[model samples]
Every structure is written in C-alpha cells, then in structure tokens.
Target: MHDSEDLVVVVDGELLTNTETICTGMKAQHASTMKLLRKHLKQLQTFGEVRFEIRLNPQGSDTEYAMLNEQQSALLISLMRNRKEVVSFKVKLIREFFRMRDALGQRDMTLWRQLQVAIAQEVDSAVRASFGSRLMLDRKKDKPILQSEIHRLESEIQPGLLLN
Candidate 1:
C-alpha cells in the first residue's frame, strides 16, 4: 500500500473499506476473501449494500472487489480466522474507522460554528438596519453595547468552547 492512500474513504457519507485492502493487509488471497464475503453475503447485506466494482489488473485482466461499510467490514473480519496478520490488520482497521469518525465529528462542529457566525451576521445586519440612530460607544465614557454587537458576541460563545 502507498503511504498516502487513505485506509477508509467516504462513500455516500459513510466510511468504507474494500476487500482488496483487507486482503493486502492480512496477506491473504483476494479470491479467498471474496469467497468468504460471498458465503456470508446475506449477513453482510444486513449492515448495508455491498457494492462491487470491477477494475483492470496490471496483467490486463478485470477483477471484482467489494466495498464494505464499517459494520460489514467488522463482521467480515470477525468471520475470518484469527491469523496473526489478520488480527493485526483488524486492529489497524478499527483505529482507521475511529479516526475517520472523529474527523467527521470535528468537521461537523466547524460547520455548525460557521453557520452560527453566518446567522449572527444576518441578525446583526438587521439590528443595524433597524436602529439607524444607534449611538456609537465611547471608550472613555460608560455606554452600553449595541444590539448588533451583542448578537455578534453571542456567535462567538459556542457551547463547551473556551473564549479568548
């Protein structure tokens, strides 16, 4: 495997790995892995549909590979014998899924934060438009924050986040 290749990829917004990857990591034959998948195909389908893709091998032959979601992949690995390499690969696969999940969560939070800022800006714009005569604050004198400023500040106060 190449150092830059992703262990898991998002397909239809879900992380997935292919039998080819599993076989490579476990040092198992691709045909045997495909056979195992076919044998338990029904059970695997319970998690999600197993999409098969055909690719041209270096030898100018076509080969089929199954793309399995996290649950299906786990189940398939569990059905395989616990060879040392398989076990090691299983652990690596688990960590890859975990890392992907964490990354997605972080991305979601960032999008949420961005939405908050966008909404806040809209609200602040409305407040500014509503109060044309709104007085500006003087640093030396005591003055209250404008409604627009309040809305802008509120956007910065995300839940569980430290404010600077």
Candidate 2:
C-alpha cells in the first residue's frame, strides 16, 4: 500500500501514521481526503485524539495534515466513500500497523538485553580498577581472574543507547 512507503511510524513512543499514507494507498487525491476528514472530524475524535500539524513546503506554502493513531486512522478510512480500492489499502495498512507493533516489542527486548550487558560491563570495569591497585604480591598470578569475569559478562558495551 502507498507504493511501499513506510505506513507506520513511532512518534514520541506512540504508534501513528498520517492521512497522506491513506490517500496514496487508495489512489485518491489528498485534497479530497482532507475534506472527508474535516467533514467527519467529530466522529474521528470520538475514537481518539486526531492531531494536525502544519509545515511550510519548499515553496513557502503551508501543508496541513493529520497524524492519527490506530483507531482514528481506521475510522477515517472507513469514512471514505469509495470501497473497491479503499478496502484493499485499509487491510494492508492494518496489517502493517500490527507488524510495526511486534517490531516495537522486539526492539524493547533488545534494549533491555543491551542494558543488562552495559551494567555488567560497568561492574567489570570497577572490579578491574580496584583489584589492579591492590597491594597483592601474587597479582601477576591472578591476572586471569579479571579476564574470566570480563568474559562472563561479554566483549563490549556501547557507550550510549539510541532513542527514537
């Protein structure tokens, strides 16, 4: 749908997509989509918040669009008068929306694993510094102890995490 453009996006940790996606997917004019949205604006809001943003294009003209959550977007699609094309696009969009949901879940799990590794690395670093400065005559013999601990943890931890 929508020529394979990204149908779903994460904004402020919220799952959302825009009206433009629907317009392109259904092969309808965006102007008509906006008109239908405005006509049923109240009905759309009944499902959830419908957000609008205005951006100045390269030509200095304002382009306005609505950023809708799952329910609002679904209802907006149902509101369209045409069905033959809209149905297929609507189905594709819904499926893609859920696919993105699962991907987000996987991302959260990966971040949690990364945090665990980072904590382990911090502990390893602290242990190394402390033992290295100790007044032990057999420190040379115990070098492998630190190596073993680091291996138990992992090879590396990224200095920072990425946020979306």
Candidate 3:
C-alpha cells in the first residue's frame, strides 16, 4: 500500500555467503551499517519487511545468500505470496484480499473459472504497470535487477552446492 526502499545482499554461490557475512561486512568497516540500512529502508514505507534467500550450490558444499532492502523485498514477497507456481494455467487468481474475492464473485462457484480469468488479467495489468514502465524500472527500481537475475540462475541449480 505504501512505498518503501530495500537493501539487498547477494553472495556468490561459490562464496558460501549468508546474512552473517552481510552483517559482518557492514559491521566490519562500520558496525552500524545494518542499522543504517534498516533505518533507511523502513522509512520508505509505513509497513515494510526484510527477507533473505540462500541458494546453495549443486555440490551441496556452499550457499549463496541474497539480502533485499525493504522495498525490493516487499515486491518479491508479494510476488512469491501471490504466485501460484507449478500450474499449467497461465492466469492465476490473486485474491490478496477477501474483499477482492467477493468483488470477483469468487463465492459464486459458477464464476470460479471466470474469476480466474479476471484475476489473470488483473495480475498481468499489475505486472505491466509495475514492470512495464522503462522509466519506473531501474537497477534500483524496487530491488537490484541484477541480484534477481543472479537469483534466477541460482534457482536452477540444486541447493547446498559449491559453485565454481
């Protein structure tokens, strides 16, 4: 609902990085870096959260950690929360709110399939609105696009691997 900023920390797969490293790196040269990052990120919105995703290597010997600032993290969390994965259906219903369900006639069993279509359209529109704008999209848009790109690659491999 509100706007926020996010700080992401991504470690290389071979490096076996995690939150501890980020905290350590930030605190190493400057002990209060995390505090600063958190403070700045929180100020971007009224309600914000932080998240960490670790992608382990294929050999299962190392792990790569991804740190997201609040805004970026929020967008990702929203996508993940709303994503109906492993589905053949291209359009999925994103009933984020109960009211949305009633509004889409979700209660009407007969309209269930139609509701899905509507939700799909809504999701497409929302994604386009958020991501389609070149002006609005940037490396620092909501999160570092680079980090997400790296994360995408990491997702393809098995966890607990040691990347070379």
Candidate 4:
C-alpha cells in the first residue's frame, strides 16, 4: 500500500477490500465528505465505524449487494477526500440534536429514544446490506446514569475549563 493509498468506508458503499487504495490527497479531501455523510446518517445514531478494505476479485457473495465497478469505486474514493468538512457539519448537527432533546425535556425523551432506535435499525440494515455480515448493536446494558450526578457535573465544570 502506498502512503497515499488507504482503506475507506462509506455509509452507502462497498466493504473495504484489498484492491481499494485511496490516495493522500483524496483521503484529505474525503475527510469532510465523510463527515457530511456521517452528519446525515447520524440522525439515525445508527452509524458505526466504517471499515475500508481493498481486495481483488472482491467477495461477490457478501451482503450489501455491492455492485461497484472500478469507475464507481474510484469515484467514491475521490469524493471522500474532504472528510473533515463533513465531520464539522455533523458535530453541529449532533449538538443541535442534543440541544433540542434537552430543551424539550422528558416530554421528548420517548420520541427521541424511539428515533434513536429507528436510526439503529437503519444502520444495522445498511451494514448488513453492505457487508452481508451480522451487525452488532451496542446495547447500553449498564445502569442508568443518575440525574444528581449529571447536574453535579454540569455545575462543577467552569465555563473556562470547557475550552481547554
């Protein structure tokens, strides 16, 4: 693998195979693109770490019905070069989502949780469709975080500390 070439995973693309290699410039540019992709998909909160691999005679039997030809594959890589831009946008969106949830209070909690579940389902489906592999849902099996602690943390943190 050349320094410029790397594995890339996209929400709506093939699994990483051995033959796929993204160039350095392309990688740099795709950072933003990936971020944006994530931002849109994050609405589902179902997105997980995307895996990128390149291989010859790509596994045809895998799920996701991947039909990427060389040209299509190359185009996807080229477009992903600006990943950070997408990420920036996604961060903003996430914050907004949180803000909305918080401001809406308990009234919105049920709806928000439901939305989260739907997003998870979509991501699970997408992953299976792409890789034909069973997707894992990270269940928050642990105990719920206590509300008092939440308030304490929020109050204890000084405004200046946040920037650091």
Local lDDT at 151 for model 4: 35
Top of the candidates by lDDT: 1
* Backbone clash numbers for all candidates listed: 0, 0, 12, 32
Name model 3 segments beyond 4 Å from true: 1-19, 23-31, 43-49, 52-66, 69-164
CA error at residue 160 for candidate 2, angstroms:
18
Predicted candidate 2 versus true structure: per-residue lDDT over 54-155, tens digit per residue: 877457888888999888898888877767787888888899888888877787667668657655655555666566556243444454664554344343
**Candidate closest to the true structure, highest TM-score:** 1
Ranking by lDDT: 1, 2, 4, 3
| CA lDDT scores, all candidates in order | 0.75, 0.74, 0.36, 0.36
Error of 1 at 149 (Å): 21
TM-score of each: 0.75, 0.63, 0.18, 0.18
Candidate 3 lDDT over residue span 44-137, tens digit each: 2343344445565555755434454334333323332222331211121111222333433432444444445554554454466566566345
What's the CA RMSD of model 1 in angstroms?
A: 8.7
Task: Candidate 4: list runs displaced more than 4 Å.
Answer: 1-82, 106-164
lDDT of 4 by residue, 80-99 (tens): 43476544433333344344
